[model samples]
Target: MDITSPSFKENATRAIGDKSLQKALGNVERGFIYKRAKAVAAVPAFETLRDAARDIKNHTLAHLDLYLEAYADKVAATGGHVHFAETAADARDIVLDICRRVEAKTVTKGKSMITEEIALNDHLEKNGITTVETDLGEYIIQLRGEHPSHIIAPAVHLNKEQIEADFRRVHDKLPPERNLDEPVALLGEARAVLRERFLAADVGITGANFLVAETGTSIIVTNEGNGDLTQILPRVHIVVASIEKVVPTLEDASAILRVLARSATGQEMSVYTTLSTGAKRSGDPDGPDEYHVVLLDNGRSAMLGTPFEDMLRCIRCGACMNHCPVYQVVGGHAYGWVYPGPMGSVLTPTLIGVDKAGHLPNASTFCGRCESVCPMRIPLPKMMRHWRENAFARHLTPPSERSGLGVWKFLARRPALYALATGIAVRAMALLKPKGGRFRTLPFASGWTRHRDLPAPEGRTFQAMWKDRKAGK
Candidate 1:
């Protein structure tokens, strides 16, 4: 996806001021924050487990290439085909080729952020294949013709009434008078519709939570068992995942999963944790006849050996977004890309160019909640600051901002000049201070004074006050 970082400011301004969005966001923020806290509180050992999870990821990323090769070998040994893709196009092409070989007319998918990142559904549809999103949230967004608004809750932006309307519009078999106001009723209707698709689908596609090198297994976590049916019922199963997903064994995968659910949706675990080793064994009643695992590189390997290598440890738990102040205001769409929040700000500029996504780094309040909550312990704010510094050095920032920073830098380097300027500014601000210590309009700083007042300084500067105290003593 192409991103225009400048649009971030405008979109964020509109999103924050939007009442409907604010209402929707308010519920989500409360729901995620509180539920996660509750879940974490329930699990007394959660913090200690987080450390284990972090170490597992750190170790895996350190030897990523080795594990990837080991995983490819294991998959091949278990009668599964492995395809290495260096880019998104490469991955999409490989999947399309597999679909053509299998003569697949319809494909059912589990919700995979990797699939969204690759724009797999669009790619498949363009090639005349029908792609069905089996996950409820993904299905709703698919019908609405919109991207996922949140990582875990794809249709989070929609209220129940809007969902009812969407279901009514999309469910052609539904009677005009059918009442669907209740959540359970709406879900039942969707479940019935999807059940038929699952049986009819020629292929199943999903993103792996982790690829186990020891057993050649691809793991997926879901609250609903739809992912189970999606992978097993079809004739062909294709696993699309990034290379960073590889782990040494099921034990290591479990270590990561322990933290994944807690950091993500705040469940002790998902309702269904399915691990597929390969195609169906001899005399097996379910699962695909053929299994294909597509390991996507897609600039991830490039991040290795760079300061950004720590980012590869991410398990997509999305805790950072939950705690992020900037993300809470604007939501994911305002980031103008698939990924959002603290992780997006750091990763987007690297995947796409710093020149295109420089604004994301500068959009933060830098409260450090993201770093504190991150399971991987990624230093997000520091990384964002690194991007900002890079942008400044490269002159990728707006010319106006660059000029302003240049003036500030010049003043900052000289104490006498800075103090002189500060005294004049404090004196000027005192003159501009209106009744009630507020100004609707002021000179030079009308940008600040137009909407809010510039507070008048309290007499002497800190340096001046300290010096006078010393002199008196």
Candidate 2:
């Protein structure tokens, strides 16, 4: 809910040292990477499919206004009210207004990063409505009073023991003799508790994977059936989604869905894929009485016709983070926002401003792992570099970093001075190298040396060695 970005150094240090979080993240990181690799390898046309996916997204973004208008008309024709939200505030207001009109008290929710981005729950609660997150992972994080750590797995930071502790704290009505050690038991208990809330909820809110323009259907894919329940059981169903989520037709949505589950969790398909066209139809056995779709722009429309347009192709599969070295070490919370990793680095800056999120782009090792794994094939590192350049252009980079770059630039312009400085610096480091060939402490680089010792720079500078070899030859 907080708009401020925390210090990267401080948050990253804590994230790296968190033992419980590391244990949890390790299992999740390894599992997803392996599964996705297996799925991709099994499919011979995966790369070609990615190319097609990229093209579809590019074309859609190029004509976003047209598709958006078409989608509005279609949804209106289907008896669904569609509201356009130009800002986060507008989106939240639209949902809250619907709840107020219906005099709703309790709201059941599916996992939606868009809702998290708009801070919908906090706003609704402030206005005296109780919102319950239905997905198991989301419910766990909600009980812990923390934002989601990972995009796909909100409770990825919590180990079983931590979850047990949280459940014991929240599940007060549990019997004294209940077993809280195993995951199944905890899950069953949560299911029982949430079932009651589901039946009692007056409204439901969810995020759509894609909105079909032809028939005005909101498509949601989930491993658990909670999303289906959230949309159907409540009297009112509200979908909060970004404008880029709309596709031209169900056929187009199907093409994207083919790659979505495989890249996300390596599944053939999620357990539940629900498509709601409108509110309950006449003579329908079960469905919401009212359906509303809030299409949020929230700075996304500005990305149109820009290099960042490719980023909107993201289906929120979260493959980039699972394979990232920095994300593996620090986890999602270190990014200090709702979205994390490569997509987060690009999207966060656009929505929140480069000045605040500038550190995220610099956080990368530029190893190219993210770009390689991204299903959308977004040029992630190049985009991050663009953000860094933008930050530099705006003078948003720290003064210390600017001064260091200035020194390097000054020396780099002169060959003689550069070679001399390199030779002296190499010899000085060689001499100051610790007993085992590593420095335990350094004056200007204490931040680097604090966590891990730096190995001594080998014998001579590259230029000096090259000159020596030339003279001898």
Please name the candidate that would achieve the greatest TM-score relative to the true structure: 1
Count of steric clashes across candidates, in order: 0, 0
Positional deviation of 164 in candidate 2, in angstroms? 1.8
lDDT of 1 by residue, 298-350 (tens): 89999898888889888888889888888887878888778888998998898
Q: Which candidate should be chosen as best, given lDDT against the real structure? A: 2
Q: After superposition, which runs of candidate 2 have C-alpha atoms over 4 Å from their true positions? A: 427-435, 458-460, 463-473
Query: What C-alpha lDDT values do all the predictions have?
Result: 0.87, 0.90
lDDT of each residue in 2-105, candidate 2, tens digit only: 75354766788888888887888888656799999999999999999888887788788888889999999999999999999999999999999999999999
Model 1 scores a TM of: 0.95
Question: What is the Cα-based lDDT of residue 272 in candidate 1?
Answer: 91
